[model samples]
Target: MALVAVVIPTYNESENIGGILNALSSLAGSAGLNIHVLVVDDNSVDGTVEIVEDFGRRTGFVSILRRPGKLGLGSAYVDGFRWCLRNLGDFAVAVEMDADGSHDPAQLPRLVEPILKGEVDVVIGSRYVKGGAWRGGRLSRRIISRGANLLVRLTVGLRVRDATSGYRAISKKVLEQAFSGERSYETGYIFQVETLYQYYLLGARILEVPISFYERAGGKSKLGPGELVSFAAWCFRQLAGRISGRVI
Candidate 1:
């Protein structure tokens, strides 16, 4: 069986980590998937690491990398991908997901199947696609999310509908090429856009699998005004780079 490493970057998510791990465990067992979860934590003081440690001890399916401080999400995932590549060398797929219960663990199979079948190099659990729905976000938040995605699509000419969606899976080749040598420009949520844009530039086959995205059931949201500003700046930079004939 091909191993799948689910890289979940977390911060202060003690309440939700256990449930997310448990759901993944159940899904892996029922589906007979060789799924290993790598939880990259940013020194969450909320006992998030303790929960993951306990769960890891119990199931032995989850392992964690504890950082010294709360680094940005992009760096967290990059670290996770590097760890997976070095540690679980046989893992064929790497999945990027949230630890705050916004992304349903049940939809993992839908996100991963395409890559396993070689149908696409990346699979996005998209909220803007058909059969997908966004639930529990406030009107302003919804507008910001939609507007940001649209702006990226127009500016970068990215083909994916939900460029900001983090619920996605990538094949090993895609992961290595996406993170090879260069660091992501946006450190926070905007990293999502940067990663997807890199994949698009690499000419990876990308597919969107419709998914229902719920608001976080516990803990605080990581998105903030700073991330929004960073996103806008990154978009403009990409536009400028494109105009200058420098492929970003």
Candidate 2:
């Protein structure tokens, strides 16, 4: 059986964490994939860690690494991926997902199937594809998402339809190559443009599977207001540099 690990970052997500853990636990035995989770939580004040610990006790399919304080999402994934790669028995793939239940765990089998079949090195659960859509969120957020992705493709030249999608699966080879050591990627994306661009540079074969992005199950949005602004600024700078024959 192939082993798959899902890495999620959490902070004060007490109201929402259990739903995803439950879904993942139930899906563990199906599709011939040994699914496990590594939740890297930045010390949530709202009893989030207790809930995760309790769930792990009952199912053993879940494990958590609690940080001392609220570190960024980038660090959470780095630590979570490293922990799973070293501990999970013959880990074959690593998955990234949101803790707020916007991304579905039921679709995980399909997300990692191509990796298991040696078809693609990365699979992004995209909303820009033919069957995918985002159900709710501020109108500003929706527009920012679309614009950021358009800029990611226009500047970075990646062929992916959704460069900002948080739900995705990566083959063991790609993970080992791009994330073997400390990498200083920013947060806000949950795994955004920089991470995706690194994957592309590694020559990873990427694909997008359409997935409907629902509103969060609970808690406020973690994305800060400045994230999009910073991303847009960077994209334009990269575009300008590329145009000037001095790619940054």
Candidate 3:
């Protein structure tokens, strides 16, 4: 039996974290998998860490990792992944999900099944794939998501349905390889795209599970027009570097 760590990176998500944790707990039996959750909080001023600590005290499968400050999503995951590697060294799977209820914890088993069965190293919970869609997001966000995915596919040569989707499951081997070196894609959401591309480049098998995205009813989205713009620009720069042999 492979130990699995479900990581949720958060910042100012106090309102949503408890409910998400409860939902995740409820899925433990139905998922038919042993799972531990690691909530990496970025020192949210909203007392998010306190809530997480309280929950951790109540649940054996859940715990909290407090960071010093507001690190980007990429770095939060990186930090949490490293901790998972060290503390939960026996874990065979490491998963990433949103703390804002956009990603359904019920879908985690399907995303993790292929990796557990040794069919793939990376499994993406995709909202753009068949049987997948989003609800309650502004029209502009929908367009940005579609366009960003297309751009990522064309730029990185990764034929993934939702490159920007943060919901994912990765085999330990793949995570080890990806984080072994000094990561360069530490920018915006493009980090997700770059990580997928790096996995593709390294010949890691990838799988996609359909997912429906829902807008958060509370708290503000960290992603915005600025994030979208920066991501596009970063992708272009990365593409240029790759073409010129400046980056590999």
Candidate 4:
């Protein structure tokens, strides 16, 4: 059976994991696809593993990876990608989504469609697209979002809409090509843009599906003010490296 693994990296998402798993399970059953849900928990002290394990037992399609600690989002995804590739082999499609339901599980099928049909290498659940929106947060967030997107575009020279969007569908081949070895990628939100750019450099076709970007129902966001600053700094460094043709 063909498999698509949605790798959800959780820090302390006890309240949301159950619902997220259920949504994925329902989506899988409806589509008749062998959907594997991999939850890469960053050693949440709030019994996140137990919750995931219980769901895994009930669903039989869920898997849990207990990481050391609160590693950054990018590293969590990298580790999840490796785990999926190693276990699922060519049957895996690497998908990244927030555990807090910010990215609707209903939209998953749309993201996976192009890859399932062998038409694209990666599919991004884009918020900056025509049909997407930000549900909450302040006015400054919009400015920050635009600024980050602009920085990424100027730096990477790619025309992707949602630079920092976590919701993405990636074919195994594309994952292997983009993350073959440490490709100068940092472990943060900017990692999404970096990965997208890496795919672009490797000549992979990326499709962006419009998504309704919602706020997390339970937990607080990890991408706080400080992380955004660091993300901007990383973008400038990456920009310089890309322009100078340095090893990035």
Candidate 5:
């Protein structure tokens, strides 16, 4: 059977980690998915590491990569993807998910199903797509999220509806191509957009699966003003490169 590695980046997500793990564990059995949950923790001061460790002990499928200090989200996924490449020789798909419960673990099957069927090289759990909705968030946040995505769509010219969504399942071939050559430029949330853009450049087939995005159930959101600024700056740089007719 082919294996799927779910890469979850964490920092101070103790409250939601265990429950998400348990939920994924339950779904794996029912869906008959040979899934492994890889939590890439950025040395959270909170007990996030402890919770993952305990869960790993009880559930052999859960493993973790503990970093020395807090790292950006893009690097966290890059590290996790490299680990999967080295260790999971049978890996067929790699998934990106949040530990904050904003992404529904139950919808994982929907995210990976198309990839398993060889329908697409990437599957994005999108909120802006048809049938997708952003369920709960402040009006300002919603506007910012929508605006950022629109900006990426216009600048990068990516056909993806949700270019910034972290919830996605990437085929092994696409993952290898995206990570093998030059390293990613952005290390923050903008990495999400960078990855999608890279996949597009590689001519990989992409699909968007509608999903209702929920507010984080517990703990604090890691996104801040700095990351937002970084994302905007990266987008502008990409736009400049595009206008200059240079490959980004």
Candidate 6:
């Protein structure tokens, strides 16, 4: 059985958490998977935690980690990864997915298959690959997403087509190495890029699979101007480090 732990970071996602969890629950009996849904919430006032609790009660496979206050996205994921590494014994794969419906739970198996077969240590659900397609969202948003990915590939030296994509699968071995030390990983939306780069630095075998990226089912995106600024600053910082012989 594939002992997979999915870590979903949520903040006021009451409108969509159920669907996300439900979709994941459906993956329970597939490929003899013993899947654990770890929903890490940042004290949402919108009853997001309540929904998670409800699901956890109904389906014994679900669990949650409640945070004190509104932490950044990067921190939420970092905390979740640490929790899984520390708690989930025999943890085989750790998945990074969005609470929004944009990331299809159906792709979970595809994302982790490479890891299971030892073809790769990390698997990324990509939108720029041959069979990948990104739908909805504003034209500007699409363009900006593409541009940001281009910048990360050039500056961070990560070869992923979708560096900003949240849908990913990482093996327990990779997770142990990623958090084995005190890493000052970014704690914002830029967390996606930083983690991807770290995996690359570790020389992990990485594979990209096609995914249909859709708009969210409900709720609004939490991205803001501050996140945009932080992302640019992070890219520049990494570029500067490379130029200064920081060796990634």
TM-score of 6: 0.97
Range of the 10 consecutive residues with the lowest summed lDDT in candidate 1: 178-187
Positional deviation of 124 in candidate 4, in angstroms?
Answer: 0.6
- What does candidate 4 score on TM? 0.93
C-alpha RMSD by candidate, in order: 1.2, 1.8, 1.6, 1.7, 1.0, 1.1
Runs of candidate 3 exceeding 4 Å displacement: 245-247
Better of 4 and 6 by lDDT: 6
Summarize candidate 3's per-residue lDDT along 1-248 as a digit string, tens digits. Answer: 67789999999998899998888888887666788999998889997888888888898888788889877888888888888888998999999998998988888888888998999999999897899889896898788889998888777667788989999999999989988577755745777887887888888998888988888757878986777787888778878987988856
Residue-level lDDT tens digits of model 6 in 25-126: 877765557899899999999999999998899888888999999889999988998888888888799999999888998888899888988889999999
Please give the CA lDDT of all the candidate structures: 0.90, 0.84, 0.85, 0.85, 0.90, 0.89
- Model 4 lowest lDDT segment of ten: 177-186
Q: List model 4 lDDT by residue over 180-219, tens digit each.
A: 5766567887788878877887888999889988777887
Between 4 and 6, whose TM-score is larger?
6
- The per-residue C-alpha lDDT of model 3 at residue 242 equals 72
lDDT of 2: 0.84
Candidate 6 regions exceeding 4 Å error are: none
Candidate 2, residue 53: the lDDT equals 98
lDDT of 4 at 166: 89
Quote each prediction's TM-score: 0.97, 0.93, 0.94, 0.93, 0.97, 0.97
Residue 60 CA error for candidate 5 (Å)?
A: 0.7
As a TM-score, model 1 comes out at: 0.97
lDDT of 6 at 35: 93
What digit string (tens of lDDT, one per residue) describes model 5 on residues 1-248? 67999999999999899899999999899888999999999989989999999989988999999999887999999999988988887899999999988899889999999999998999999998899988877898888898899889778877677898989999999999878666755679999999888888899899999998998899999899999999988888888998999988
